[model samples]
Target chain A: MTNWQEDIVLDCSGLNCPLPVLKTKKIMDGLDSGQVLKMISTDPGSVNDVAAWAKRTGNELLETVADAGEYTHFLKKRH
Target chain B: MVETAGKKKRMALIASKGTLDWAYPPFILASTGAAMEMEVGVFFTFYGLTLLKKEISPKVSPHSNPAMPMKMPFGPDGFQQIEWPIPNILTGNMPGFETVATSLMKQTFQKKGVATIEELRDICIESDVRLIGCQMTMDVFGFSKDDFIDEVDIGGAATFLEFAAEADIQMFI
Candidate 1:
């Protein structure tokens, strides 16, 4: 609900571990530096996984929003 | 472990099993490691070398595994949650039981939105994760380089050790 902007949207709902992170990396690879991506996932594990993946891959995780059972993450591609 | 500045972390995994249930760990870890920007290599040896075949149909046999739960992939939630206690004798002696179990497991994985082993292996290859097949195993099993997918590199133990020695994480699966 915040005013964050994104250059691409990836929906990974119903997918499990590694898939979410894998798909996120695939999309991020195609994005230009500073471009933002909004990814939504239904896997509860992704809450921590996204943060860890962002840190390890040097991407910036702007914020994560949990709405009901779904978790939405906003990430910026690293320069 | 000493952290070398500006060097990517490396992971080395040895896969030695070929069962459907056991085949997942190496590919899953390798692909994920690559996604995390780590250098990853998976050495396939013994029965695990079969996983590198162009057409792999790994089957699960719950005959000796007492802890494996039998669950249906379809039906109502309550029905699906109920684990059927299948006798080991039937699972072990019944012909085509392994095929049934394999299909059921695949169905459950599909229902749960899990990726197939082949899909994960494709991701590993796409991410440049090094897949090394054991040359000794290939010779013993009469497997030629053409028998496996094009992405696999055939090597001996020394090749795997060379990569694993520098790896931050090493696993035997």
Candidate 2:
């Protein structure tokens, strides 16, 4: 995967369901189009949640890395 | 995407239980749905109306809830820890176990870094999750509109079903 410059890095470790997604959306809402976001979540549900959120919101999923119970995702704002 | 700004997918949930344990599901799903850019609504009915009450911080009653597992203060962090399961016979003998269990649950959630019910409610409201208090339940329970928190809508079953009928996801919790 290409290294896209992350405009925002959201650390969602220790957060359970709904929080990771909610905080991600809140941050993503403030980002400009074409800007990138890097989100790290400890919740396993976020693996599918972030991907689905990207798909549902028309954002571009650039990279994803899962390491030792933590998930890292890079997404670009589409609109 | 251009034409679908306000026309995002919708989700509706019926909250029927008022216990602390029962409160998590509806708000969790509703808040996540809103985060996913969907319109979310949670209709509080029956005993669930207590969830929307302004002064009531609902507590779990382990006296009747046998399914709630007791959590240790520590997680499974590669260190092997022996867990001695307490016999229900012993627990049943202990008085005031319900209060102890309820506080324990709250402590466990705090230790796990999970949000409290108050925080989750705020998140749901901020994320645009519509909170509708069942009017019939309120009337039966002698609760007025002022009994609930701000930003709550009072409605009946038909009102909730209207949103549920068009929602992609409908839940009865």
Candidate 3:
């Protein structure tokens, strides 16, 4: 994981496909450009979903870590 | 090409099934598309029109439809743990079995923390996803404008096709 400080943290554990990315998008919309958000998810689908979400939303995915079936993603708002 | 260059990304989705299990795809995809700044439109055709109705909660029961897959939150191990055969005959024959099965499925969804159908519909509305009911199906089914939710619009196949033509992604669910 990157050392960048997170402006906000969203925990989407126990949620299934679409919820993690959907929740992330909702939270990211409120963030200003360059602000970072850390997302925690337990759904395996999120591994791909978060990456695609960041790309589609024009955000920067700074880091992604998977540990003990839990995934953590760090994203920076672009616009 | 240049005329469409500045336009926003768009998606057109067709919902053709009315089963509760089938209901998730169109709304989920629409909400996700909307979140990614895409203009999303969902066309509810045939039985799918039931989903647009006000105060009507459609249901799915594996007991009634043998082809319908049972989704348990516990994964493959959940099946092995139960050690039950496919199409449990007892459950299928029981009185009010559909109601029981539907409730069980709803409970599974809750345990998984997934959004409910109603919540997902609201999400679509909040995200500005357009919901269009098929005019032909509505007529055949004897449905009126008052049958659908306030956010729904009634349209024909041609109207949906017009939206589909401009969309970057098209899905039939």
Candidate 4:
């Protein structure tokens, strides 16, 4: 519904690999656990980078969607 | 660029022997910062510069400190099943352990098609993340300016300390 962790939009446009996760950590820090963080990234590798980071960092991968020319995903801080 | 107001974002990858875990933190954090739109810098000193060395590691060390970041604990057949330096001081405690992790990371990235450190370095420059090589460490390690990857500025603890002071996130790997 409203304020899902991913709903907090963090548009990481030009940033590549490790940055997406790093950025996600920064944004997530401001929110409570169970809240979602939505990320909009242009880097192709971000698809896997974020996924791997979420797993490594103990975050939740609520969703990962790929649009025409972009990748979007939601990460919920579980820890 | 969107302003990350009140964002407690800062990092210094203070690396000593440049082992597996040590190498990843700074860059991983640095890249993470750029992604988060936070200011990031990498201060490579001592053996830590080994990660940024022109040549990356080839494979995991089957010998010393064999356990390392511990292969992520995949399964019985996975690399983590092996032994590594647990609770041991990273530097010199397990010689060659850092080397193994460094190279294995590179190989993993290469296998995964992740961006190389050199590539990440380029992105760091564009994102305004400072990439500084420790002058003192370089000298002691007998590393010439040429030995390091390009586009790194030379500085010592003071230089990095300034960053660490302002940085909300700092890691000594």
- Please name the candidate that would achieve the greatest DockQ relative to the true structure: 2
DockQ values, each candidate: 0.55, 0.62, 0.54, 0.16
TM-score of chain A of each: 0.96, 0.92, 0.95, 0.83
DockQ of 3: 0.54
Reference contacts recovered by each candidate, as fractions? 0.63, 0.66, 0.63, 0.26
Best by lDDT: 1
Docking class of 2: medium
Q: What are the TM-scores, per candidate, against the unseen true structure? A: 0.96, 0.89, 0.89, 0.53
lDDT of 2 by residue, A1-79 (tens): 5677898899999987777888888998999999999999998888888888888888888888899998999989996
Which residue window of length 10 is worst by lDDT in model 2 chain B? Answer: B77-86
Candidate 2 stretches greater than 4 Å from native: B1-6, B74-93
Predicted structure 4, TM vs. truth:
0.53
Superposition error at B128 for model 4 (Å) = 2.4
Runs of candidate 3 with Cα error greater than 4 angstroms are: B1-5, B67-80, B86-93
TM-score of chain B, per candidate?
0.96, 0.86, 0.85, 0.64
lDDT of 4 by residue, A24-77 (tens): 766776878787788888888888888766654556777788887688888886
Tens digit of per-residue lDDT, candidate 2, span B1-173 = 33466688899999999888999998888877887788899999999989888876777776565665665555575422444466677567788866777787788788666788888888888887999999999889898888789889989989999889999898899
Q: Evaluate model 2: give its TM-score.
A: 0.89
**How are the candidates ranked when ordered by DockQ, highest leading?**
2, 1, 3, 4
Determine the TM-score of chain B of model 4.
0.64
The alpha-carbon deviation from the true structure for residue B11 of candidate 4, after best TM-score superposition, in angstroms, is 2.5
Better of 1 and 4 by lDDT: 1
